[model samples]
Target: MHWTIPLTEPSLGAEEVDAVVRVLQRGWLTTGPVTEEFETAFARKMRVKHAIAVSNCTAALHLAHLLCGVSAGDEVICPDLSFVASAAAGRYNGATIRLAGVVSQDDLTISPKAIESLLTHRTKAIVVMHYAGFPCRMEEILAIARRNGLRVIEDCAHAPFAWTRIGHQAEFAGAIGDVGCFSFFGNKNMTTGEGGMLTTNDDDMARRARLLRSHGMTVPSFDRHKGHASGYDVVEVGYNYRLDEIRSAIGLCQLAKIDQLNEGRRQVSAWYREALQGLEEIQVPFLDRPLEQSSCHLMPVLVHGSYPEIKQQLANSGVQVSQHYQPISSFTAFGSGAAHSPFGPWCLLSLPLSPQMSREQVRYVTDCLREVLAQKQLV
Candidate 1:
């Protein structure tokens, strides 16, 4: 079942294909020089001292938790509105997860006040996810961390090139905290098929994360292959979370033009806002947000009436849509049993969004949405 306009799609092309082919021709598939090159390029663009490429964002978060010394009986405060991996990463390190509510219905980022309220003797760190590419209020959140001596791990899956003002200067999403984790999944602003990046300004943490990324070895196989070392040593216990050369090469290509691609997403978002205006039953979040500051990773709207019926009707009209998430706390694994906000899974709908989306497509989606609401007498 194909929709006239899909929710999201990667803007892959000849460059990505050529990069993969070059990697295959080089005969080095695992983490190698190409991976290092990708890491360097990413770190430079992100304005971070170090960037360690990993298998996925979950792996990056897990590494961040381990490096921050999150362990059994400790608690990590995370956004209840984000993807489950935001909380699951801490659980992997044996840390208890403390759910933090969002700022409000209009701004879905983790609330700084909620984070402060959740702090306890066992609290070790705060994980803030920039919801839908909109940067979280980092200044207040960082102040909270400083006063509590807690680590701040930024989940930047939705915010690759996104930035915000901290003091008088602008800072990138992943570079503002103690450790920043990023995603390069297929649907993300950038794509590497399945990969992520861990960034930090702390030199010691960067060194440790690099060592821990590939089984805590004194020297990786790439160095050995190049005759840099005859033997290697395992210094610390680590997991096999290395990004392959093929994906790394692809990431290089994606990173080069991510800003342009993000601009296209912003345009689509603008069209959506224009087309969605005057609909009483529909409320678009981040209406005041400027496009330059965000990557515009998602286009979610809060429906005042029957969301399920609206969604089904839109689908029937050949429009594909999605939900950014159901609050992580609502999952049975987390055992919260309910959503944290009134704008929960059933009320929030992510409309079709992509760099390739055209104004006509956006108008069509909104037209269908208007029809659906009118049919249900929601507006």
Candidate 2:
């Protein structure tokens, strides 16, 4: 079921291959110097004090929940429009989830007002996801957290270099919250095959996350193998969520080119915006926001009529499309019937997007969309 253009593609090249080969040649396959280097580079890029590389984004989110004191009986408030992992991480710690609606159809981020309304004495933390690499209304969200004495965990899976205005300063997505969790999956702005990074400014939380990422050992196996530590002790209960050297090396290569790659994405998004403009049948979210502030991980459009039919038509035309997410409440696992976002997920359409995309490709997609809509009107 391969379309002419896939939903997304990672920009991997000879540099990544060389990086992986170098790691294999070094023979220290587990998390070691390369992982440390990746973490340092990522932290420096995001302007964070500490970055703990993990097995995946879920591990980073779980660690963030633990570090923020989200435990059983406590509630974690997050957007209903986000991927399930946004809430699942809190559920991992036995915390209940409170779903908050989005701001509007034009800005599908979590509503700070909705978050404020859902607060309870049992609320422990607020999880905000920057949808499609666009910064959430972080200034307001952070103010809500500060007012409620709740920790803020940013789900930066969709936003790597994206930033928000905080007062006169521009703070990077992962650096604004109490703890930021990032994904480096194959489709993300950057790729490490499967890996994640947890960032924090708090020294104590950073130490705890690093310790807990690798089974709470007093000393990591890498250190012991290098004669830096004679022995080790397990001080706290933790999981085996360490990123290996191979992925770290690849991550380094990806990190090096992320700025340029994201710029390409921004350009592609702009092309889509221009191509789709004046098509009253479709609406693009976040149009009011400047493109430079977003990593533009996705090009989601709100289809006005018969979304399923249009999606199928696009498929027939050799175009690929996707949905950012379905309401978390729609899943049987989360059927406890929480308030859902009113952004009409059923009509949300994600057109193919990648830094590799060309203006011609975008125009083709838009043309297909217009033709499909015209055909539907006659039916």
Candidate 3:
């Protein structure tokens, strides 16, 4: 079934097209000048000392855990309400993945108090996911980490440009933690087709991450190409998680227009709130959070007791909806048990949200949802 309104669509235009064309015409691909430029631009935007581009956000997370000294016998705390990558990255580094509960039904982000309760001697880091591009309660979370001597790695896949205030200063989402990981997958606020970036303020960690991102080489291929270095030596064991020049080109273009794209998403979210207001069956989360700004990557609603049926009904009406995630603990590999929180697997619905969507399309989706709920007598 073709969706009249899809869950998300990348905001691509002539700038992205031209950037890709330029990279292709240059003939040199792989991690080269374009990738370096993209990393530089991203680093500047986040106000971080370094931004290391990688294959995807998962790679960024894995590398961050390693840099943070998470290893065997160590435990990492992550929200149950996020993509599995948040927890799985710690597991990749031989750390035990401990689950942390969300704040509440109204705010699907990790609770700082829950994180504090879960911390033990073995806890090495806390991985915080900014669900739906809403900034997590970082000020409180940071205080917790400081008191416990644990590192913090932000899973900022949904929050490319989102910010929150700490006292009188504002900080970007990815830059707020010790290490921030981002995704540029097709459905994100910005797209590089498939790419990721890691941001950090520590000089030594940045150097280590740069080396680890490309086979732990002393010199990168691009540097060698420019004759800045004659040969390279492997200093440490690392993975081949480098982002190519083509995707880097796309990232640079997307970064330039990210604010505009995010604003469009915000407008659509506003339209959703106004149109869906007074519908008792649907609960919109994060309407009252006091963030300086959000990237608005998704628009999710909790449909009281009407999930798969409502989903199918919307599909039949030519609208596409998605579940943002099933709690990490619900997976068989992680032990198929319910998450500690009430907002567990399959209860939430992510509506169509994208920069390309218009107010008319949003209204149409709400109308379809209202009809579906009435048919089921859910409203």
Candidate 4:
């Protein structure tokens, strides 16, 4: 196909539209039954006991920090390779942010040992990300967190069902952590336009997350919506992080097809790996095995040398390729002079992998990539 293919696109179907229509017809468009249904289905799909839907991944992270009771000067260790929202969550709750180096170039997930080395009396939590659907070393990281009495907050933005195993047992990534956060943004494994979900087994933590997602409203939102009861009150100040019914309706529908969409992404990733197998300078991405069955959110790759030129060439060839991310430290908010790895963020590229894409299409894109890499002397 000659048309533009986005790096990540929603796997929306007719079911999503029908569900949203039902919700819109109901007239109560705020957080309601649809949101609750999305939460329940998301929790069940993740095989966890609780899931709280919110406005976005940022809200989920902020609520996790609040539930952990992280405050000013308290440190939370997070990977520098991920989106800024991961660390900003700590700052949102008035906590000190501590950055940790990535484990390897392969997956770029945070190393448990790196996190352990940074622990101190002020350390409050470990915000580990499942980079690009590749599950981190959860067992090692959780062991360190448990040993240090530090809370583990999972960032599932890139990983959906990515989890762990223990000698004939199964362990979902977010379930093992103290609190887990997930994004349903358009570019994620699955999307709700803009939404997030939080999961935890602890009842107290679940309650606190609920309060924080709302405006710290003391009354159940359902009751306030009914207006049959007395007026509501805000017991604690909170952000407006609730996921409205319209978005929740979309999310609930999306959750039902999560496995199908995930499988498509996985197949696309496998095809990319196989097609680019022998290219000397082109390295397609892979998740660290023995742990995660990644949802394959993106197919970011390294083209040995001519990375920038390859992107330009691919664009000229009518292919849409993009860098996975820019180093957060390179941004103005984090300051300009801080040193970043030469290949850390700028060196990677993402290929399209949606259910809407076909095997032939994936091959076409890869062929274009191979051509560009070769022309640029990268492969």
Candidate 5:
């Protein structure tokens, strides 16, 4: 009998359980020392200055927008083929969002040309998502934003340490833009069940984010007790987006193994590339390029003609296949009345590739997909 495989699973281990138990023993299970340690380690690992932990990536992006001076009637340019939180970041700030071009069927990353067309005088910020852990064309996107005098916020919900290569070199994904946001949900490479991080080099943005993430309070609970005072004050309107110690505790241990985990995912991705290459029914573009310096946060494949059936076929074979997203603008909260356009609502499927999965298991999952495609004469 064949076994089942998950699309994306967290590479967790005993460290997570041990950390959780330690945090529980500490008794002050709210945001505290462990959260601070995780933030610092995250900042160092991502090569950023400041890291603000939050409830999730949505809150991180939302807080980033709020601190970036986004307001009602202001416009933010975003990629159409992104996770909903990317655009929702602007919506939470009461900003009008305009989603434009993403690399068509080739990893679905946003294109600079598509975004440049949407910019106007009201365009305050440009949120670029590293779709499926693949970095967008940052140099071109940054050039466009600079020409328009717009703030750049990287939606790194997909790509954490994934690097973007331009010309002969590469740089970490989140480190390129003004601010970067990351998700640590259970499905991510490293997870704390549900947590997020906001990273920035700007001191003021960091201060505001620190405050905004915790009720926009007059003080961080960490520093509150040092003054021997229990009463606190609110300086600005903020949300309860703080990451708790319990989650951070788990994150700290997971962070240590992130690179190894990413390497494992990369190996799985390479196996899929080798197995799925030369197939007419699908294409894996990112694979043809360099994988040595990349982090495989997701393994989204471009489905070719009449390929939707492959997803069902693979599922029936006990291989749990799924799409990375349905695009941000496809949802009613951000889309047209009801019938959202395919430009932002169409194809892109994530293949099973997790660090915890063995090489043999990875090959089997791709074998199932390969078998289905062959049966359907898709190749």
Candidate 6:
């Protein structure tokens, strides 16, 4: 079925097309000068010392876990509501996953107190997802991590430029932790078709990430292309997770307009909040958090009951909706059980939101949703 209002659309314009064309014409398609430039620009925008481009956010997380020394038998605490990548990264390094719960019904982010409760002597790292681009309680989470001597890997795939205040200073989401992983998939706030970046301020960690991203090579393909090195050596076993020049060029273009795109999403979300008001059965997340600046990547509403029926009704009306995630603990591979989080997986509904969507579309979607819920009440 064709959706009258889809979940998201990438805000790609002439600039992105032209950038990709230029990269194609240059013929240096692999990780080359353009990729380097993209990494530099991303690092500057993120206010981090180094940014390493990779194939996707999952690869970035895998590299981060590897660099952070998440070995077999080590426990990594993660939120139950996040994408599986958050836990899978640790599992890739042979670590055991200890799932933590979200804050409460109103806030969907991972709770610092929940993380503290799950902490043990074997806990080596905490993978925190900034769910729906809302910044987590970072100061509290950071303090907890510090007290326990645990590394913090921020899964910032949903939050490109989201930030929070630590005292009087503002800190970007990806830059605040020991390592930050970002995604540029088609549905994200920005798009490179498929790509990701790993960021960190620690020099040693950054260097190791760069080395591990490519086959633990002493030299990168770009360096060889530039005649900086004639040969290379495999310093250690690594994975091929490099982002290509075409995607890099597209990423650069997207980075230039990210703020404008995010602001557009904010406007759409504001419209949603106002239009959704006084709906007794629906609850909006992150309405009370004033200090954190969200990237507004998604607009997820919690429905009290009959979620599946409501979702199908919306789909029948030619509106495409989505669920942000199923609880990681509920998966068959992970074993069927209740999620550790207070926010159950079945209640949340992701509405249509994108920078490319117009105000008329937003109004139409909300109008249809309101009509659907009202009709359901009548029955």
Could you estimate the TM-score for every candidate?
0.97, 0.97, 0.96, 0.93, 0.92, 0.96
Better candidate number, 1 or 4, judged by lDDT: 1
TM-score of 5: 0.92
Separate clash counts for every candidate: 0, 0, 0, 0, 0, 0
lDDT of 5 by residue, 57-160 (tens): 99888887887789999999988767778888898779999987666565467878788788889999999888667778888888887887888999888787
lDDT of 6 by residue, 42-158 (tens): 999888999999999999999999988899999999988889889899999899898888898778899998898899999999999999999889999999989989999999999
lDDT of 3 by residue, 1-379 (tens): 5789989988898998898999999998999989989999999988999999999999999999999999999999999888988999999888988888789888888999899899899999999999999989999999999998999999999999999998899899998999999999989999998999999999999999999999999999888888899999999999999999999999998999998898898889989999999988888999896433889998989986546787898999999998878789888777566544255432699999998788999999999988987887744
271-346, model 1: which lDDT tens digit per residue?
9988988878888888888878999999999986555677788889999877778888788899667654456443
Candidate 3: worst-modelled 10 consecutive residues by lDDT: 337-346
**What is the lDDT for 104 in model 2?**
86
Name the regions of candidate 2 deviating beyond 4 angstroms: 336-341, 344-346
In model 6, what is the error at residue 232, expressed in angstroms?
A: 1.4
Candidate 6: where is the Cα deviation over 4 Å? 337-346
Cα RMSD, each candidate: 1.5, 1.6, 1.8, 2.4, 2.7, 1.7
**2 or 3, which is superior by lDDT?**
2
Number of the candidate with higher TM-score, 2 or 6: 2
- Residue 198 in candidate 5 has what lDDT? 92
- Go through the candidates in order and give each one's C-alpha lDDT: 0.91, 0.91, 0.90, 0.79, 0.80, 0.89
- Residue lDDT tens for model 2, 38-126: 99999999989999999999999999999999999999998888899998999999999998888988898999999999999999999
Screening candidate 2 with a backbone cut-off below 3 angstroms (N, C-alpha, C), the clashing residue pairs are none
